[model samples]
Target chain A: MGRLTLPDADVIPFGSPGDPDRPGRGLGPSKAARLVGNTGPQPTSPPAAAAPTSRSATDADRPEHSTSHDVITDAEIPFDGESWLEFARRRLMGDYSVDDFGFDPELTDRVLLTLVRPLYRSWFRVETTGLENVPADSGALVVANHSGVIAMDSVMAQVALHDEHPAHRHLRMLGANLVFQTPFMGEVARKAGHTLACHPDAERLLAAGEIVGVWPEGFKGVGKPFGQRYKLQRFGRGGFVSAALRTGAPIIPTAIVGAEEIYPMIGNAKTVARILGLPYFPITPTFPWFGPLGMIPLPSKWLIHFGEPIRTDHFPEGAADDPMVVFNLTDQVREQIQQSLYRLLVKRPSAFG
Target chain B: MGRTVLVTGVSRYLGGRMAALLAADPQISTVIGVDVVAPDSPIAGTDFVRADIRNPVIAKVMGEASVDTVVHMGVIATPKQAGGRSTMKEINVIGTMQLLAACQRTPSVRSLVVKSTAAVYGSGPKDPAKFTEDMEPRHSPSSGWPKDSVEVETYVRGFARRRPDVSVTTLRFANFIGPRVETALTAYFSLPIVPTVLGFDPRLQFIHEDDGLEAIRTAVLSPRQGTFNVAGDGVLLLSQAIRRARRQTIAIPSLIFGTVGRTLSPTGLADFSSEAVRYLTYGRALDTRAMHRTLGFDPMWSTDEAFMSFVRRDSADGEVDVA
Candidate 1:
């Protein structure tokens, strides 16, 4: 596959290029023409000539094929913010309402929210100490440390948020490419509102003012070896901070206790993994080799805490560019979430204890 | 010179045949036949003893007979008759162990010959190749059939290891056909509306009753003490066998019969249905060259000859055969 590159110019032009004041106006025809000229138009002809027929041989019979260079790249595809919003609306028509996007407009979302309450009660054992901390209606990035080898904890967090909050927002999760490649699992993930965790995807969701969730540690956090349980894995040089900085969304540092014990990875068979085309052959107490009997996770009573939101509006523009500042800020946020989880772990007894 | 021999399960067809053959031999003075119930008419000059080998009385009986060799064939041959592993363990494993222990106690008993099954190999390539005594048993849980065979083999090996004085020989007998063959193969072929292959073939091996008895007689008489696979002189597919029998054989996918048999019959996972599927679909040909080389004996009848003899006998008996 070819490498994915960022667009030369931003797809959604929020304000005038090199200007701050002019916002919400669409890029004019001159800009559109320039963009088209730079990248060329989509191919309008087939690659092969049509077979000759006895019925008619007209001027259109000439072998016409567009060159590969004529096709526009993703970078040059013009994005109208209103058009995208309308597209998303149309795609979700009838099945979903505006209230479904975490608004208590007609109390329909409240009923749907009620439907998943039992699952929340059984799964997460969700206890909200600071219900006041969560804004009644705002796009907040709930940053939680991912546990469980396959981001099952992240799913439970989504389930918990949708169940507890009256608005019932379905948190859009940013997942890795591997998650989307698995057979039956990929479809289930898309239905659960999880998209590939790329800069463009994250930025687009954030720009749309949707509640986005991310695990900075990625697979490293989930697939921590048997020796390191509950200990956080390394979070790569702060891409999450940059996304938050660009969108000015509050980062709600969340801590989820008890997801670590669900499936304890006792051992791993590297040879089996290479043969099966899996990243790791986890020898958990139960798994892929066995049936439903293996799928059952050890019942660990869950406790999810939504910490006070850390506002990003105060930071000056381009604060993400300062390496030292970004590093220090990312470290501080990581330490805060880590310490909170450690404290929670100590406060509660074992899942069964 | 006369020798004394103890044969367990003498009431059964193969055991009875072995007992009668040994009794007829002038070298054998006395033959002790052990069973739960004594045979109505014992083999000529053979002593009938009522004793379950699973019980401790087996050692006492062997002690009284002072037999020179013990041929153990006292096992529930079919899984349905055996019930489950526990029941099979009581009869096959524990019973074999008890008989082995009895042989160990009797000072005169120098050899112990046990009847094992070729099904111990489970399902594999039917490449007409020989499987030596050392080939590991394929223990599969798809059905309890393979497990039962493996367990029996394991118990025998353990017993052999524990008793160094006794020379143990296990014979893995092939599918046998004779006058009284009542297995699924006989039942399937004897049916009025015989199900034959549409076009596909099946490789089968059958030992005649007399030849099977000769194999046991030779094993008991000879002082050799290793395992050997015993089968008929040659191999033939079911279609070929039916054709040789001069009977009309239809051709059909073996799976259809298996599905129908499983659905219609009460013996869903019995050895009969499983063996039928195994033979008709995935037939295996065993190499019995070692039996000829070591025992200096060859099966007198081929599968076709034995099966034809069976068909002739059935016809003469005027039995109503239904498929």
Candidate 2:
């Protein structure tokens, strides 16, 4: 059977040569066209005259053609971001439980977590205090200050918990809905043990005797301008406290410092964010100016401090339903995190030291 | 008390097997198998009737036979079996509408079991890991068998509303794979070389043909209210499933996966439709807790066991008559 050829250059232009924004780099049209011509369709492309009708005719003629175990010469397609070995490793570690949340422990530990370990340990030089405050084996809601243009602190905190804590517990983080809606990001987040930051999901994870993490500051803390960098934003609605109250899981107010300096959000592209259906399109000093290179996060000296765990077991039977209790508890946790962040910042010698 | 049961699409393997199985039951006095064409092998203790379910005459047939229960197994899974896309759609959607209309008119029909598919809960990126019976499809299928299944189910719901007394059960079976079953999934897996969407390994679930038949038998014998998700326990990733099938895989980018799939779809190696590729991109699974707790039935085979069984059967024959 003859091989099917890719459409001609005229028909499918992936990236225009003249598009300045695209920079004609990173697996652009030229590479795609070359890959298609050189590496695609191993059996040899059908003759130009036979191109259109070739597929159907070939199909009709040889119905049970056994190409099983044949070497697929067409490997170098677009999205050539990961090496073959890396890709294979990811595949091997992709198994997960039958839960509806789609959390894959193998993928998270071997791929996603490992992918960021270097950044957390060496690049950020992260130091953690009061690690003993985190419960050894049971469910607890770790409430932390959310910062950085991107929420890398949450991931670093996850790494800290997984690597440092004696019990090596996993933190099932509650994330924004936007992350789950996006294509690749959504899948990656789920595999890394993050679920929708709604009450039901949070309560389920907590009740299951798993460590749960929440950054109630959300987009406000992450997308704040550089001038308001270390200042803690108002924690939203006290939903995390309600979840803690309902599950009777202790709330550990965790604080992270030095994250606000990484990719400092100097300006906001509100229009672009709206178009993309994102919370905020942040513009740092290096971004757009340096293109893809701007995405490289600055190596900041990090410090994460865990405060005393607040006992929710003492709350009355239906304290979760009480607005005043939820509100007061939310303020208490927020205040602890805010105070801890200030203390950690004062102790640090320099941002990148 | 004996039942007069009418089963549709008797020409198909599962339909014929189910009809024959039901005839053996002491509770069923008579079983009538109706199809557009005759079955190759005559099923014992059953009467075969040649009739187009799409025709209004189906209502008369249901009335004349005094069928107390109706088993609608007429839904087509693949385009090739039904002659083409348009024909499959007509037989699946229009035929179902006509059959349900017939069931609505027949007051003697106390129970209805509609064979449905898990494809209605499409495999989208944003879909919950496992689909429960209650959740709607993340994205409604645009065309082909999945679309038809959605329509068929909608018609069944409408029929239920009209006949409130009748016990309606919709068993949304996961992709069926076994020695005797012929489906799009089986055809795709039987391919010598399978091409998959690059960088995506979706979880897959399957129910053995034996389990599938037994579920139908259970539904027919002990009719239940509400929908149930019918799949074996556990799931297999697409890559792992291919490895088990002992087939070579070519991973193409999503950009060219469609073009490559379009080229391969007609080749008869795989049923590589746009919908099929979407399944590959985001593999689908169903939560069968309802199938156990609500429907009160457990599949004999797990997802892995079912696929392995199919692989063993295919290897023994080495050639499948895809119809």
Q: In terms of TM-score, which candidate is strongest?
A: 2
**What DockQ does every candidate get?**
0.01, 0.09
Which parts of model 2 have CA positions greater than 4 angstroms off? A1-102, A175-187, A196-204, A217-219, A233-251, A269-279, A291-293, A307-336, B268-274, B317-323
lDDT of each: 0.60, 0.76
lDDT of 1 by residue, B1-323 (tens): 58889998887767787888888888889999988766757666678888878878988887887888888878665655456657765777678777777777788877888777776765432221234556553323234444455676777787778777878888887777887756556766665445553433345677887787778878888856778888876555554456444454454454476665544345433233454455454344565767889867688887667877887777777763323
TM-score of chain A of each: 0.65, 0.73
| TM-scores computed on chain B for all candidates | 0.84, 0.96
Q: What is the model-wide C-alpha lDDT for candidate 1?
A: 0.60
Worst 10 residues of 2 chain A by lDDT: A63-72
Candidate 2 residue-wise lDDT, A1-353, digit = tens? 23223232021111223222422111211232232221212223322322111132232122111111121111222123556577665454432243446566655654576678778777987776665566655678999988898989999999877654434467889887677655577657776777778776788788887789999999988988876766677799999999999988888889898788898888999999999888889899899679999999989889887666788888889999999999999988977777776566656667877
The alpha-carbon deviation from the true structure for residue B5 of candidate 1, after best TM-score superposition, in angstroms, is 1.0
Q: Write candidate 1's Cα lDDT for A219-269 as tens digits.
A: 777766654665666677787777777777767677777677777787777
Consecutive 10-residue window with the lowest summed lDDT within model 1 chain B: B123-132
